[model samples]
Target: MDVAEILSHHILDHHWGYSLGGVELPITTHTVTLLSVSVIMLIGLYWISKGGASTLKRLLTAGAEEYVTFIRDGMVLPNMGTEGKSFLPYFCTLFLFILLTNLAGLIPNMKTATSNISVNAALALCSGGLIVYCGLKFHGIIGFLKGFIPSGTPGWLVPLIFPLEVISLIIKVCVLALRLFANMLAGHMVLISLLLMIFIIGQLSAVAGVGAAIPAMGLEIFMTCLELLVAFLQAYVFTLLTAIFAGSVIHTH
Candidate 1:
């Protein structure tokens, strides 16, 4: 099989359908990975909550606290201020869920759900909905609509600027979805391409393939380490952007 096909198998969502009477249920690899991520988060939180006397448990709890603090002080509060406190659970959950999903793909033979645009779009929609809700909740319907128009635009200019502002709002959320999807998907594809080269070269000459293995393996390790950093970075960026966007509508200052 070509490298593209191999990459697709690892990155694309695989679906299985079951029919009972006329009803059909479809479960995809993304479904599995998302569920797995959820379970891991639940278990991690439970472990942290049900504290143990062991050193490992203490370290784990400490790390979890740091994550929460970082998201609160670093991402949420800075963007949304006191209004953000209510959404801490959501932003924290988003970060952890995406972090686990990205990290899961690094595991041998496991799929990354966020690699799918649909999954990321679903997440984007959730954040977008919250943004709109917050705008309306604080400003009321007319005020929320007015927020789209800049405070200083002239009447004739507003007609043009208003649509652009709405479009910009939409593009921001779209970026949230695409940013994570592209980063995770591209990182994995680069890794696969590097590894694939060793095998492709192997087909030419056994000795040449062996020669290729050293650099390919080395690059693969380096890429994996880089991807590990990216996994965390993408999660942080998504949460930070979400907070900023939500903050925009919440404060409008």
Candidate 2:
């Protein structure tokens, strides 16, 4: 059977709920599965990084060093100026977390956190909220509020422009959340569905099925690599966009 068929059967077999602690929740198989995997990966990372110079130590150090340098040189510094240096740790953490989460899904019997809407939404909110917080902190309440008003608008247009600008800002947050959630979710769905095709076709004829399965397997492998790229790209994009918005508020140009 294809991965999608298996997932569909599993979902049908298990009653799902979105709740915890007696409170209703957005209970999804994907969310629970991915979160468990993420926790385990995080623990593994922590354990590997805990000791002095050993093989695991060197591996962890090299991985972290490369990731940190990538985010610092490629993403933050160019966009946010010298002040961006202070944000390096936060960006690096976000990037590694997402990258690990994305890669975990490629493992047999593992789930991807980025494929869950709740997970992606939480990540988006963190980045978006930081943008708002930094904006207010650097610019103060009045300056932050005044940011909505464009430089050359007439007094009469301020009333219309202000609300529109505020709404647009709100839309940016929504788009950020939706973009990540949709991309990750869609990629997984496509891969699973393709696997399912191989299973169904194989049932009809052994040779035909095997032929189809070979290409499908190759495509899945390619997608696994693509997801790795996406994991880092989304992390960098989120942080870079946040810095751009924050910088606009601070510099007001």
Candidate 3:
């Protein structure tokens, strides 16, 4: 295969589906990764429920419990105050879902669902929807929309302010989607390029490239560790931002 095909294979989504009524319902690698994430989460839940006295089981439960508490107190409560408790379930699910999907990319032969732009966009939409829903629930449509306008604005600037605020809200959701999609896509591309370098160099001088591959392999391993940390960090950042946005909409200003 040519370079373009190889790169596309690594970067693009793959579909596995049959045509039905001339409309294909794709079961892409991202779909499989998402399913895997759900199963992994279920397994984590099972481990927590087992309440086993084994060291590994206890450690898993402890970690899960700690993460839940962290998201609750550190993220949800601080941002949403007493009202945040209502969203604990959503916060946990979002964090764990993102975390699992992010980590899944590191596993051999497994794809990253969040790397898909559509998936990231969908996630951002969900968060944006929640923010809007909360705003509308707390304040009627008119009131909720009015919160977008700055207080004490000049009447002459009313038209500009309203449109700007609405645009800002849309931009927030778009930023959330692009930030996540870009990060995941860039990281994977970097990893793939690094590995590909070994072969590219080997094509010219087999001995030199073989020697270089050793250190390259080591760097790749280091990157794997860093990627693992990034997986957690990105998940936390997304969850934190969603909480902040939700809180902002739920309360005026």
TM-score of each: 0.94, 0.80, 0.92
lDDT, candidate 3, 127-189, per-residue tens = 999889888888889999889988899989999999998999899988888888888888888
Residue-by-residue lDDT tens digits, candidate 1, 1-253: 4877987876778776767787776677788888888987898799787989899999998898898999999998999889889899999999988889999999986888888899899999999998999898889999999999878789989989989999999999999999999999999899999989999999999899999999999999999999999999998899899999999999984
Report lDDT (Cα) of residue 122, candidate 2.
Answer: 84
Candidates in order have lDDT scores of 0.90, 0.72, 0.87
Two-way TM-score contest, 1 vs 3, winner:
1
What is residue 19's positional error in candidate 3, in angstroms? Answer: 5.2
Model 3 residue pairs with clashes: none
Best by lDDT: 1
Model 1 lDDT, full chain set: 0.90
Which residue pairs does candidate 2 place in steric collision?
17-27, 18-25, 18-26, 18-27, 19-25
Off by over 4 Å in 3: 19-25, 50-59
Candidate 2 residue 38 C-alpha distance from true site, Å? 5.5
